[model samples]
Target: MDSYRNSDARPPIMQGSPPAMVPPRLDWDRPPWNRWAFQHIREILPTAEVWRGTGHRHRLE
Candidate 1:
């Protein structure tokens, strides 16, 4: 990583400090199996779109 830094682009005064690392958003460190379970459940029971209310019962002749 040190080779990537250029003196012309970056000043030599900031060499003492290390680069900052960003943490994962959703606990990526966990095992893949745990993540797969959550993804599958969402697909099985997806939200439904309700168009109309319950219709009234009709009388037979």
Candidate 2:
């Protein structure tokens, strides 16, 4: 498995300004890329904020 982290040569996916790799929009959710895609879903897909009335207060650990 390729580390979600960058390899010796290149930066991690989507790290650079124009993005290092944009795996086809159709397969952005596929194996190798899904790792990063899932973490940045709001940026990758069109998402609207839901009114949950003040989301989780605890900062990410």
Question: What lDDT score belongs to each candidate, Candidate 1 first?
Answer: 0.52, 0.77
TM values, all candidates:
0.18, 0.47
Q: Which consecutive 10 residues in model 1 have the weakest lDDT in total?
A: 20-29
- Which one wins on TM-score? 2
Ten-residue region with minimum lDDT total, candidate 2: 11-20
For candidate 2, report its TM-score: 0.47
lDDT (10s digit) by residue, model 1, range 1-61: 3565554575667565674333344543356644654555444345666666688867788
| RMSD from true fold, candidate 1 | 13.7
Candidate 2 runs further than 4 Å off: 1-19, 53-61
Which tens-of-lDDT digit does each residue in 1-61 have in candidate 2? 7785656676466665675656678888998989988888887889998776766777668
Error of 2 at 48 (Å): 1.1
